[model samples]
Target: MKQVLISLLLIIALHTTAQQKTENVIVITLDGFRWQEVFGGADSILINHDKFTEDKKGLQEKFWAATTDERRKKLLPFFWNTIAQQGQLYGNRWHNNFVNNANPYWFSYPGYNEIFTGIPDTAVNSNDKRWNKNENVLEFINKQKGFENKVVAFTSWDVFPWILHEERSKVYVNSAFERIGFQSPTFNLLNEMQMTAPRFLGDGVRPDLLTFYIAKEYLKTYKPRVLYIGFDETDDFAHGGKYDMYLHSAYMVDQLIADLWGWLQIDPHYKNKTTILITTDHGRGDAKKEQWTSHGAKIPDAGQIWMAVMGPDTEAKGELKTKGQLYQKQIASTIASFLGFTFKSAKTVAEPVSDMLSK
Candidate 1:
């Protein structure tokens, strides 16, 4: 009897410790941001663009009057003023930065796969394959004894189902051109909207607004500990060279982030414990001319990306000028560290960017 009683007490203590150390971490991927956007501020690109002509002069005026740091703060105001002010921003400088790739092709799928798995898989070349059977670090963590119900992912791209290996139902994901499963009424509505969403006027790309909405709704209803929201509109618009549309899409995403963060703050359970980790899979070119917006295999700048983090264990009003560079894989390791979870991927990068963590 005494042995059983001791075992129960130990189990209770372990459970309590796990509950206290756990945190809700949400990752938002901003598909194609130029490093210049964070480091350079608005320059000649704003002036020549017809759509931004009105705001161009004002932006220039503020940029010139402010210090370089201040200008950066202005362009990504929310990040510099709020998120960066509270957490850490990476990849804007030449300091101790280190870089690596999980795949030879530093494009979307490879980058994302590296991020979720902790290392790049050389064998995986394209996202052409319809399904991913490989286990992800997120999935591994979710299967652990204490974290069984905590991991979830929502992405705008149809490939995520395969990318994260959710096609087999191991992970929860809503992707693919065709709707595959059914859930609640709210999800049904979301499915209907996605299915019926009008394709872009000229090209046939499907609008991803529905995915964002579904992710938001899922967050509100499920309150999962880990959430991944991937937005592709900016990447699509950038590729189309629709400057106005690209900027608008980015702004809209910004608003959504503000809303998401606001909701977290107001929620009784997550208000004090949630962290928002935002980054991009890749970046676009430096050109802001006729070919201003686009990124891919041909563009060297496309491979570069940055990250911004905010929330619990993140510093308040802090900026990190790290000399050490990190690749996409570090993101997963950092998140696991924040959540007090053990990541099981053999390739998972264990080094957490310390500057971002709360002091």
Candidate 2:
């Protein structure tokens, strides 16, 4: 009887500890990044396109290389060096691993909707700046115990405020040119810096670097249980036919991710318990120079995208050079799983990736 009692007590104690573990989750969107450059490398053909680049020789010397792996490493060294080795990456279509948006509309609104709501709604066929009717995963998480008022979003595009349905969701969305308010000296400095920087498209989009700094300060200060940051320069640069700027933005975003992960490891609230899920709202065309800057229903495979997961509870599988496919709707469930929750998909179209979580 004594031995049996001891075993029961041990089991209960372990279960309680597991229940008490605090897991922080951060979701980042690269905004219309392509898997071609993510997995394969910089496109040699596109580098010399007169329409896309002004200094082909200079760009080539910096990002071009004899091999795909070599080029990718130079472009995104932190990702290839640290995240790839320690985390899991998917959507390398060349290896038959596919991840695509589920929404029929292969654009920002629908793709982001599918990602956050866990289902593709044909009703969201346009990128109109209207409040989203669908409920998002962040809102759902906020309703959960201990997560109320602890969910926040920082996005470079003003459209995100509508996508998140901030008015209805009450998720504390500080997006685009909207200030996040003063939390620290660093955040205040960024606020002042924003005043001096030139506004993009009349503040519909802010600089990606500014967004990163604001979100970073928010994470360090408030320690929100769930955070989402959307960086949009890649998409903007691509549309403007500035390939060099696009490439540089991609590299900068990687470093931002590295910095955030490093901070999480140092912060007591996030150390050893933070999980990051990085992905894009859409994928741009890359079949030709023209297609490289385009993503829409007409663009082939524009809905296809990629994702990376890193945390204490994730497998160290690195780049998934194998046969598999994931839909954007599955991301919400994946995020929930990272925090030890079993969330039923809002649309119930798919489940979380079984391999993404730790055993």
Candidate 3:
């Protein structure tokens, strides 16, 4: 009996150790998403602004509210109702969660570089499509013992292939209209829909919904240990000054996240063993109409952004209303920490937000 009890304890300890050593990680990015809409909901100030949308009465009726709490819930019900209840939300400037970009350039390439590489580079100045020179944390993780060939990136933006250095990194990358062939009916349906759906941008970019579906299919099929999803409809609409489409895009993406979370809870592989981080490449402007439409060196406060983390491994802190700064660059290391990997990047910029761990 004594020997049996000892063996049982050993088995339990081994299982727990394995669980802690290999946590699945999902990193999601909403391109150029603003922090304003995240916490305060639809900007009551910009909802009906003439530059953003001419349908003033329609906009007011749809998103208007008496308070910030009410408006945010209406705009992003999943974030407010689900994620906030289970995880942590940062970069609510009003609440003192000082989350913002670390790079000087408030654009996609530089911002994404900081996020993946954990370093800010002045050379990464423009949005020109080119392979990044810096090695991202994804590549580093892929080189690790247990994570080799386990990393997958699915992006709606065409530039992601270059941004993450897919060629150099040797990480599996499917961007824009790139879809893997699957015998499943779901994949077939999504591919057919993409064929009929209107192309929102150039370079074979399809609707974000299509991207979401493709990623979902890939998730169930491959079941990668590390997955990165890049959704661009929110930024695309914002750049086009289509406030209605932007709002819809944000809300729909939130639904995708909720659905994924629900599915994860049922999947034995991901249930209670995955850590997901939702954030943006960069932040849009909040000051003026033009700035709101554009993000760059000229726009003040364009570096401000937000991030949310939820999983069994993370603490149930909800929103970080406390006062402190968070850099987008730290995300890579944070992910590494959750997956039982250390970045050890020579071009390191910052340490992981250690409080992010609870597992």
Give the Cα error of residue 269 in candidate 1, in Å.
2.0
Off by over 4 Å in 1: 1-22, 41-43, 46-75, 94-102, 176-185, 201-206, 288-292, 346-350
Candidate 2: give its CA RMSD in angstroms.
3.4
- TM-scores for every candidate against the unseen true structure: 0.80, 0.92, 0.91
Q: lDDT of each structure?
A: 0.67, 0.85, 0.84
Q: Give the TM-score comparing model 2 with the true structure, all chains together.
A: 0.92
Clashes per candidate, residues 3 or more apart or on different chains: 9, 0, 0
lDDT of 3 by residue, 281-317 (tens): 8888763556777888788878999999988777889
What overall lDDT, based on C-alpha atoms, would model 3 receive against the true structure? 0.84
Per-residue C-alpha lDDT of model 2 across residues 1-359, encoded as one tens digit per residue:
99999999999967854854438899999999898888866787778788788888888888899888999897888778987988899999889999988887789999999888888889998888998988888988888899999999999898888999999888999888886566677887888888888986467889999999888888777889999999999999988888888888998998888888888888888998888889999998864637878898999879889998887777798999889878998998888777767676345646888787753
lDDT preference between candidates 2 and 3, better one: 2
Question: Which candidate's TM-score is highest?
Answer: 2
RMSD of 3: 4.7
Model 1 agreement with the true structure over 188-291: per-residue lDDT tens digits: 88778776777663222335566677778888887787888877787777676665455556656766787788888899868878888888877766664443
State residue 171's C-alpha deviation in candidate 3, in Å. 1.1
- Weakest 10 consecutive residues, lDDT, candidate 2? 13-22
Error of 2 at 14 (Å): 7.9
